[model samples]
Target chain A: MTPFSYTRAGDAADAVRLGAFGGAKYLGGGTNLVDLLRETIERPSALVDVAGLPATIEEREDGSLLIGAATRNAALAEHRAVRSHYPVLARAILAGASAQIRNMATVGGNILQRTRCAYFYDDEGSRCNKRSPGQGCDALDGFNRIHAILGASADCVATHPSDMCVALAALDATVHLQGPAGTRRLKLTGLHRLPGTRPDLETALEPGELITAVELPALPAGARSTYRKVRDRASYAFALVSVAAVLEADSGTVREVRLALGGVAPKPWRARKAEDALRGGPATVQAFRAAAESELADAAPLRDNGFKVELAKRTITAVLGDLAGVAA
Target chain B: MAIRINGTETRAPADPRVSLLDLLRETLHLTGTKKGCNQGACGACTVLADGERILSCLALAVQFEGRSITTIEGLAGQDGMHPLQLAFIEHDGFQCGYCTPGQICSAVGMAAELARGAPSAVTTDLGAATVRFTGEEARERMSGNLCRCGAHNGIIAAITQTYAGAAL
Candidate 1:
């Protein structure tokens, strides 16, 4: 591992100042960044420890949640208000990493976690455009069973490996970021970019910007939500395909629905096309299947991952069916 | 940097890249915390920081400036072996004994979580303040610690026996 200097940030301003020094990144949880440092995938000149920032959950007057960026995953998963109102968020986080990891990783750090793509980690061998810009993507022709099928370009096809971001996408969460310029609010869906030409530019976070909090809008009354992840193992594995959905049906007709998919795209795929198809339609398994198909109709798969199209379709159908009490 | 570990104040000179696991084993010479898959995939480097279990392999030595860390070596008291340690021996909870320290530390932390009414992933209702620990819950919570020796059954038995005895 490359050697780097470490300094603890006294506050958000201190963090930004240290970060603006260039070749510096904020360290929270140190789960992913430390691993990358050991692999020599990320070599920074300095690390500004940002774990001591405001790490609390404040409930708004409208019953929405404003979660601090430094809030640990375990705390967010077990918070009373989150479990009652945003069960999908809690369940999504729990379904992710193991207990030890969740206890250590913060919400901001989890959002900024790197993909687990094997090729991206191969610094010497694999031709990964994300790791090295303008270089060809090895996953395009090499082992790509876990590569992205949507929102991918010729430069890269690496999928974002985050379950929390998928739920946050479906929930319409807003990320509050503080940068050297000033503070800004970015929609969760717009935070992560597609691998179009520059997979290196992954997130919308500006250089030296620090995420302060994530504000969740209130879900509609009587809405039901769930996160279903399909993986090679029941535990301790990345998703083959995961779906996060918020649905409300009245008199057997879909009232409002929001759907987002993971492990299929460079970013958390909000299935707006599918939601449009299911807006006022009858909550039936056939309708769910058609909607899922319509959303995935534009998917372009590589040789080893064409099966992901069918897997994602069925997974979405199953989640929507269970949410609507339709057998599928 | 100075940190408290196992009721002892220890100091490690400035090193940004050395993980807490490396500091304990190499510098502090506490080898009880095993280093299995140093990339945080395996939980053999699990330890308690302020009573919460975290992956020490991924934690940098500098971040834990004044925190209190509890390793497996600190579990036993002057009276001899801890109850959980005795239960593990009685139930034959290990074969290669590589992942024992992590399993034990994680179980200790798991018990504290249950006492504080923290819910696990297997709990159906997240709103419930506390979830009862069944054999399945124990196994699910301990999935981070992998035992290649296939000592899961005995490990579960040991934890269950120790927990039940404590409740009595």
Candidate 2:
């Protein structure tokens, strides 16, 4: 690791002030940043520790969950309110790294975790545009098994590896951020950007901006939600294809539906068309299958990831069927 | 930086870049905590902070000021070993023992979580305040601690036996 200065921030203001300076990064939990620093993936001049920020789990007046930025993943997953109301989020967090990692990983750090692209981690193996701008991408043709099939560009095909972000996008969670300019809120789905021109700018967070909290709105009554992640191993492995779905079936008809996919796109892939197709339709296997098919119609698979198209479709169908109370 | 390790308070030079794993092993001579991956992926350097398990590999020594830390050596008492430690010994829950400290510390924290009614990802009822310590729950909770010796079956059996009669 490179030599750097470290200072503990007193509060959010102190963190923002220190982070606003050039080549300074806010440290939270240090689960991802520490590893990145050691690997030379991230080399900041200074680290401003924000673990002491006054953050907690609280319920707003409108029955929404407000998760503080510094709240540990373990705390959020084990919170009574989160387990009872937002079971999908809890399930997503539990499906992540592990009990020990979850204990030290904070909500803010989880949201800001970088992609697990092999090329990006390798400083010399393959030239990654995300790691070094304008250098080119090696995952475009080499070992593209885990590359994204949707919302990808010629410059970068790396997929987002967050299970919790997929669930948050499907639930319409809001991220509250504070920067040197002030505070702003962005919808979770809009927070991420497509690899349009600059594949390096992954999130909408400005420089020196700190994520303060994440607010999850309450779901409708009688809504069934689930998060299914498919990986090579049972635990402690990144997702190969993950689906987060929330469906409401009223009297044999689909009332409302929300779907988002992970490990398949540059950002969380929200199935807007699939949700529209399911709304007001009969809750049957045929409808679920059709929705899943329509969602992946525009997927552009790489050489090794063509199988993910079928796997994602089947996973979505199974999840939606289970949520809609339909079975084979 | 002042921190408590294994019931003893100690201070180290203000070196923020030193990882907690290195501080324990090199500075304090607590070499029981192994460094398998040097990253957070492997739990070979697991330790207890205020009775909760954390990855000391990624933890900065400066961030742990005034916190209580426990390693494998702290598991035994004047009388005998902890229940989980004895169970591990009797069950032969290790082969090379490189990851034994981490497994023991993680199991200690996991047993506490089970006693506190924490649910695992495989738990069917999320609303259920109390989750039973079934075999599946134990497996899912201990998935983070990897053992190359393939002693998982024995480890699971030992943890089950230790927590079987407990209220967790």
True contacts kept of 1: 0.87
Q: Write one digit per residue (lDDT tens) for candidate 1, span A128-209.
A: 8999998888999998999899899999989999999999999999999999999999999999988789999999889999
Report every candidate's CA lDDT. Answer: 0.91, 0.89
What is the C-alpha lDDT profile of model 1 across B9-109, one tens digit per residue? 88855778889999999998999999999999989999999999999999998788899999999999999998889988999999999999999999898
Best by DockQ: 2
Q: Which stretches of candidate 2 lie over 4 Å from their true place?
A: none
What would the per-residue lDDT of candidate 2 be over residues A51-160, giving only the tens digit for each residue?
Answer: 87856999887889899989988988899988887777888889999999888888888888889999999996879999999999999989999989999999999998
For model 2, which pairs clash? Answer: none
> What is the Å distance of residue A76 in model 2 from its true position?
0.8
Deviation in Å, model 2, residue A167 alpha carbon: 0.9
